[model samples]
Target: MNLSWQTRAQSIAQMKAETFDILIIGGGITGAGLALDAAARGLKTALIEKRDFAAGTSSRSTKLIHGGLRYLEHYDFALVREGLRERTELLTLAPHLDDPLEFVIPIYADKRRNYDHPLLVRAGLFLYDLLAGKYNIGRHRRISQAEALQLAPQLDPRGLKGALVYYDGRTNDSRLVIEIIKTANERGAAIANYVRLVSFRKDVNGKVCGAQVTDELTRESFNVNARAVINATGVWMNEVRSLSADLSDDDKQLRPSKGIHLTVSAERLNVTTAWLIPAIGEKRFYFVVPWEGRVNIGTTDTDYHGDKDAPGAVQSEVTNILQAVNAYFPSAHLEPSDVISAWAGLRPLISSGNTKQATTAVSRKEEIFTDRDGLISLAGGKLTTYRLMAERGIDLAVEQLRDHFGVQAKPVSTKQIILSGGGIKRVDLEAHAHKIARAENVSIETARHLLHNYGTNAEHILALTHEDEALKQPLLADLPNIAAEVIYAVRAESALTIADVLTRRTRIAMLGAAMNCVEKVADLMARELGWSEEKKAQQIAAFRAEYEREYLIAR
Candidate 1:
């Protein structure tokens, strides 16, 4: 089924009429993975999301698919190993979205990381590669200070010792989740965004059998009967669990830690590889990643007590990030003016210790809970390990189906759930881009951009350009995204609102051109999606407001 607005009506009918073998709540990467796993295993599956897929942490990730290399400092070898293994799995399953990259960590003789000598870094890197074992992308090596400067001219030269270079991976986190969702739908999973779970519908014996839900767009409430209901909501797990029964307030399973990131012009930050820079205080750290045409400097880990739905980086947080960037890259001279975009994401870390203390040390390990009432809830995990988390969550749900529902479903078979954009090897991608450029009459850069995000499906986008020659033009003068992408998002990617296109479907949001071309983007969307003039204005306003509220530095 094409995952478009047209298909949503049919999906809703299915959601209302069919009894599913497994119904999953939450459309983040974890939930999407679960739906794909269950459906691929020959179980009747359906998924519901209160908002858009990846509206929460799934879209707000640091945009990396690497193993948890930092976890090694605390001796969490198993966690690192599982993540490393998943990294290899993702690179194979979706080669285009998740590509391997070299990460440079420069050592300073007078910096706070005094313990990180060249030999010590080598030992850690060796252990990291050992954990990855056969799945390792590349081996780590030591680089002289001069060689390090050649890669990143921004690196501070004074008191700088040699650097350590290691291999990791990067990805468009939200795009990855959306592709997984589309694959699940193609495999017969009826998944709909903006359909929210209202409450639990229980049997006379008080075990979960179904749920009451409302479509947010239409506000029509209905019942969805399912043999097993799994709550995979990230930060909102507690809220969904509360709907089923009276759980204690003290039974909070998620401690949300807010991590914020900033994007600046790549020309200003200037780095060939991602940089791991240690923070000066709070025992913190951040990553300087090369993303799109910008540099992403991020991630302050502080316990977030604010509203989870509207997490934004405040001025002080922005100042701290720029300070870190400038301190590491003394010649970069970055300031608030240099920042193109800034946003915050709440990490749903599982609290295994004192909840009253800081959330910085909480584990990234995920846990699945089966309530005595038969409601299952999942919390805590990283984006890189989402597939593994789904496998484990669905395994337990399959057991529950046999025990209570009498539905004998097939075993998990998602190890082969080829993402919709799969099968494009790295070596083949360049030739594919050249072919697309020649056939579509677009720039090599634009063709490469489409292939990177849509992989083999780039042809589908190219087909749109033939119908409207104007669709080949760039969405913004400087951005690589073209107008055909907006139509593609509406027709193939199920993007509903302006936020869905600019924020998740395309790179406009964090790539820093959201405000500059909102009206142009909205006009194209209105023509394709059949929006009224008022709706177009509303969408433009909402997209601009979202950028101001979330992506802009609140100075």
Candidate 2:
């Protein structure tokens, strides 16, 4: 049942032999959520991803689970309201991955811009809290200029004014996607990564009945027959649609927005609470989030017309973020050299012909598009409301199934079902982690890291250390990550490539010394997966190339 390379052969064979009720394309959060919902409802489901799970926008997000407070400016109350509800659900369903964090919006007296006015900001927070209702993490409060400085010493005190403090949730974006996929697989849904949907199979009536899939790793082609096909690919929606049939100029959809973020050491900024700072002259505001012991500052939203697969962070984009961070925290004086890593993601916004509209003005509301060929594509939604998106997408899919195939399926109840590793209570997490630490004879930090990242599944990793003491050693002296994580990713998670282990599974590639540990981790993966020496070398080189391409900013 383990989702490893060893099981991929068997899984692909099964996929080709058996007919499924639903074939899900794209393994991001939207597709993962739908697969879990469908499988939980007792439908035969299968999911395929061309790259690693969450390899797209899902992994490169600002990493907040908050209702978009800025959406209030655009009067996007419904999107914000739905996002708030899903935020609360995720905190309860996956406490280990999502946690509450405090945010402050500093108001300046000298710069009384309409958006930065204290009264206006407070009013927005009021509506934000009202929408959250009982699900509100904490009530918003106002503080004096002095108190604001006390809370965030690094803040620029030149334009002294008060600030508003509110609460929201943050998460490890990639890890959340992986957990959803794993939960679906555990529930009997056949999920395969590195499997690309090459084309579609249609009947004489031109209805999509199945898909032609290819294993990217093995270069093997096969066909999977299904009663329904769901296209959940994010920015690549139009690209996948082309495989079914060409579209006219008017039919071309998706206004992809490029958003880039930079990661710096927490010590450089030294802010305990997250900050929402309005850009000097733009309607958009940049986020200064503290995550994983580092400061994550980001996200410039501009219309993108580049290759979807290679959304690299340009120097101009990085400079914009740096200027914003420096303006907010004058004392920090953060330069490009302070940046540890940088990433870019494309938001799949449903295009409105108004090319004059700013990217920020685009609505994040999701839409389900069904063509005459029965190809259902879900596009243009934020990560916060993925569950609701899935529910709506599946409702349409089920309706199609009943109408076209004459099949009956149960209703979805994914809200009641906790995702994998969600059963552990927050109060008992420390004690449980302590017990595991003692049992495994590893450091407390290491145990807590495992518990937080893998949740209740930490025990499975602890077992690896028991089998081989070498697995308990740290991958890097400064990092808490152990060698066992690399092995567990291969044996338990479907990590086919070194990039899968380093970038998505463990996040070692984003941290410092990523290149230094690549060969070592590759060696462990080779030992477990039986990679030849040449393959191991290839993995190391490929991982380094990806890190330099996607993460490294030119010095």
Candidate 3:
């Protein structure tokens, strides 16, 4: 399972021979976590996805690894505790990818807000710190109105009572997903992206034994068998449910809600700390987070009524975000022109009671349903608690496999294992980064960027530089990433399209605010990878279209 995207060819070959012990669907955080869990438990496992890894809602999150402080308002102690515990684990396991971030929530007067907002927020942060225990980054503190203004100059000064400051983890959400997939591959989980689950194959006993899959890029079809199949598809769970004809409407367990985000330059929000604004009439709070030199200000939770694959961030929703942020940060009055980019994602929420009652009232916890037909589906978990979701999903699948195959499997051991580049133990990460740069004859800045992004695996790209010095040159003249990385993503990460490389593998298109630089990379990639002229044209067109879709504009 050397979980690199390249392993799909081998997994597809192996699937043609016989059935695996467990087959997991979805390739986002939960699905990736499940694959790693199952493989580590000594269960012969494989995972498949319909799109690139984290291409869905997983990549378009607020990118916070907090204990859900707002959940404390709703008294969801269990969910908060579990999330707190997972946050500690993720920080310890992937330090290079996850780091501590300070946040401020200002108390505004005349807003008809709670008088004890500071104390309430303090209590939540205290509990969050307590749960993190030895792994906690820092404790919560209170700042005077003047101090708050000094920290965030753009914040509205009028009627400012005080602020509650706390620390939480921030991460590159998509990179974390990719690392999990790589770790699962290291543990023997065969995972592939751009592979769609077409239908289910049942055995003589009417149990789901495998799935019929179609390669979205090549349009080729194949069959793979498994003792137990798990559908971890986020918003697309109903499609998998429909594949099994015997499953009825009752089998559909998802009610997806749309979460939209606006990407703006980090300069717009000059504040260094992430800010949380109390919602005027909603249970939710808006977050202004920093990521990759940009401010990922989002998001608005609302009931979705549209296609999950091509969901658009309507102008009305964009207006809501801008209005809310402007209400707090008067100096940084943002408009549509300030938007570098925007995106919408469908959270595959489990439909239990009235999902429309209150957007904040909906559960953020996951639900596991093992049907009588032996198809296991896990849905409705937050990005913070994906590992727990995976552990439960794999635990259930193992029970089904042991009973069916008459063989025992090993216990899960992912809790203590370091993944991919995280396996490298470095006392001085900065010094190590410089060493790699000197060895590769690349600049220290370039080396530091790579080492931070990929940890020890940065050496792989450097190795390519030694073979071809030209590969060391940057893809775009101004970008830090080089051609070696683009080639590595295509050849090693199993990226099938130019958008996959620009959007996920390198994140150039999103950061640069257009595909102008990325299109040039795509053309260079086309020549190096031996892509047909028509193929290159098609990729360029697709890249432009996706840019328009995410930015909410028509070309």
Candidate 4:
């Protein structure tokens, strides 16, 4: 059930003739989750994305599957409970992707922070552990100043008393989203990337029925009819909503906030544990999490009133992160040059003006909107709670179906249904995978990497190598990626462009590489994808242009 160009063309052909039970507009985690839920519930489902899966904010997350310790500061008990519960569920579902990560928050007796900060933080951690009762990995503990310094000697010793060590989950957000799409495909949902929803379709009664979609790659237009059309475009919800005819000003929903993150080389700050610094200006604070062998420092929560598609990190936001981390780790002495990458994500929050004066004040809770014409839009939720959001969304759609078509849908069964790699539940999967690889006549290192990425489905990847030895060779000399992976992505994952193959299908963009290695990998992918010489040149130019825009350009 791998989604390919042929599958996409078939879906378009079917959409032109008949109506689907459910047509999901955004192919992100939420949209993909909704499609899986609907299809699992016996509904004919279809999902479309204008770009690659997770091309938007889902891929740009802080890459944490945590209970959000800072939410406790605002006394958000319910949000904390929901996030903690979802965090544990994700860890259980994807152990290979979501691993235990410890964070150390220094209890500094600074003039800025109240002297009773340690007690406050301890209370918060206690509540966090309690919320994650059965799912708790480890309890929070306080370490002495000497012990804390031993853990991270690079810290500034001025007024450093002790620190709190608590456990949470870290994950590769893009990989998780890709797995979700894979799981949806396994459940019989038709998915197409690089397809844009250009217009909306309505029935004779003027009720919302379907969408006129265009394949961005081929510039071919087709119409899809469905019992319900759901717009799950995160920050672009409003843009999609405008396509509906019967929507009014009152139904206009969504207030998006941009959060920026800066990536510094791990060598810049050689610490083992992640950090939660009480940064100035913000009501609570921000975090400096260590992820993927790099120091990921981020997240400035400010209103972004700019273009949603291409939001750039401002100079002030970068300065705020550098200044805060510098206050504690003065010895790291980080500067702009140490940054390998910088990214920004927009959080699509529902604005309830009476309750929330600012976007950050609004709950990250999911909201669903259905006009009189039945144009449904879902917005405002974190990646951790995507499944829960989907459950709610599908239930709402089913109710709409009963009213409109006099049909009743079956109950959702995704709660017990595991995802792609999550289907197998084993204790020592690492050792077991090695044995399987030996039987398949592949290298142990290659086997381990495949298992980490595809779980039991690693067999499929290796089988390709066994069939064609040339496919097993690494794509680039410096990278660990296999040449077969590029073909796999195009044939199975709907990677229409070189950027989709390099950036999302494989992590060539995120993985720090030498300048030549980056260009070489891009060129390799271009060749494998059968791009023309001019196209290959264009891709290299585009990759370099993006690099300069993100890293090299001076503020």
> Could you tell me the lDDT of residue 456 within candidate 1?
84
lDDT of 4 by residue, 375-472 (tens): 88898878888888898899899998888787777776676767777655546677867796678665666666666666666666667777788778
Candidate 2 lDDT over residue span 386-456, tens digit each: 88899898889899989888878887578987888788877778998899888778888898899889898
Off by over 4 Å in 4: 111-116, 245-248, 251-253, 280-282, 354-356, 424-449, 468-479, 514-528, 546-554
CA lDDT, every prediction?
Answer: 0.87, 0.87, 0.78, 0.76
Q: Per TM-score, what order, best first?
A: 1, 2, 3, 4
lDDT of 3 by residue, 339-384 (tens): 8778877888876656547665777878888777888888887888
TM-score of 2: 0.97
The all-Cα superposition gives candidate 3 an RMSD in Å to the true structure of 2.4
Candidate 3 CA-lDDT value? 0.78
Task: Write the candidate numbers in order of decreasing lDDT.
Answer: 1, 2, 3, 4
- Tell me the TM-score of each prediction against the true structure: 0.97, 0.97, 0.94, 0.91
Candidate that beats the other on lDDT, 1 or 3, i.e. the better one: 1
lDDT of 1 by residue, 1-555 (tens): 579988887888997898989999999998999999998888999999998899989998898887787788778889999999989999988988988999988888884753355567678899999999999999998899999999998788988887889999999989999999999999899989999999999888898988999999889999999989999999998888889877775455678899999999988999989988877654667899998878898888888888888789888999988887788898999988888888999998878547776676677888888887898888888999989898899889989988876778776567676799887897899998999888778889999999899998888888888888888989887878998998999998889999999999886888888887788889988998899999899888887888788788766
